[model samples]
Target: MPISEEHIGRTYPATAPYEVGRAKISEFAAALGDADNPAYSGTDPVAPPTFAVVLASAAWGAMFDDPELGLSLSRTVHVDQRFAWTRPLRAGDEVTATLTIEKVRARGTTAIIGIAVALSTTDGEALCTASSTLMHTSEEDAA
Candidate 1:
């Protein structure tokens, strides 16, 4: 079944607190081709802007596995992504992400799902808001 507008506004549970480590930040930065940047090489480094996606991506599993949405993992394609930050993530910050379904639109056998993820400090300070759109094509040949 295709997702509908009614699925919008559905919020999922918060993910477990994930501690940001300096090493991981360095690794991510280097992977993004910033290996020589001083900002990401120190013990108290600030994460690259896109690092929030690391947390958001993990929390997204819940939405895909939800039976009500009936998503076909194999058929989904990430169409777009955007991020809004109150502050850059720093190493040693403990954060959690909560995902919400902002919108669901369908055309023929294809569905576009808009997901909003809120990343916050464990004590409730806002960190970042990440929004993503995924397009899922209906499976017509799978057994």
Candidate 2:
């Protein structure tokens, strides 16, 4: 079955609080092979504006793996991404991100799903918001 507009408005709770730590920041930066990025390095650590990808990667699975939405994980492609930052993430902050399905649109061979994910501290202080557009291609489009 193809993705339907009915999947819109689905919202999922925070997967888990990802603690921002100096070591984790270094590891993330190192994984990307960008150790020279000042914000994500050093003892007094701070992270890049888009460091929220760490949280997003973990939280995104809920939607794709949702059987009700009938979204095929294999056929989906990340079409676009934008990050809006309220502050730079620093060590010792525990952050939680909730993924919300904001919109779903479909035409002949493609479905565009938009999500607004909120990344905030346990006390509700927002660190950043990531908005993504996922394009799930139909079998025809894939072929």
Candidate 3:
């Protein structure tokens, strides 16, 4: 079965607040081999730009868990990712993310999904928009 085109433009509810912490920021920067950057360490550190993906992934959980969406994580390939930031994430900032289905295109047995996650402060200040493209193959098609 194919993913319904009706899913396009569907926006999932905002995820629970995720508190940004200095340790987590340092960890993420270290994973990227940027641990030595001054901005990513010390008493007050700003998260690396791509760190929004952490919050965005939380928002994506809603769509992935929606039975009606019929998505299979095992068969999905993340093809692309882009982020636009209003401000860099900082430690101690509590944030939430809301995922929106931007576009859904079917190609043979595969579907290309375009998704955007809006990351914001718990107080509702927009922080960043993380967009990604996922290629998902239908179960029957994969078999």
TM-score of each: 0.94, 0.86, 0.96
TM-score: the better of candidates 1 and 2: 1
Candidate 2 residue-wise lDDT at 125 = 97
lDDT of 1 by residue, 1-143 (tens): 45778899999899999999998898999899997888887666899999999999988988988888888778889999999999999998999999999988887778899999999999999999999999887765333
- Please give, for residues 1-143, the per-residue lDDT of candidate 3 as tens digits: 35778899889899999999999999999999999999999888999998999899888889988888889889999999999989999999999999999999987788999999999998999999999999999887877
Per residue, candidate 2 scores C-alpha lDDT tens digits across 45-110 of 887666788887678888878877667778988889999988888988899989998888898888
Give the top-scoring candidate (TM-score): 3
User: Which has the higher lDDT value, candidate number 1 or candidate number 2?
Assistant: 1
Clashing pairs in 2: none
Worst 10 residues of 1 by lDDT: 134-143
Candidate 1 — number of clashing residue pairs? 0
Q: In lDDT terms, which candidate is top?
A: 3
RMSD of each: 1.5, 2.1, 1.1
Q: How many backbone clashes does candidate 3 have?
A: 0
Better of 1 and 3 by lDDT: 3
Candidates 2 and 3 compared: the better one by lDDT is 3
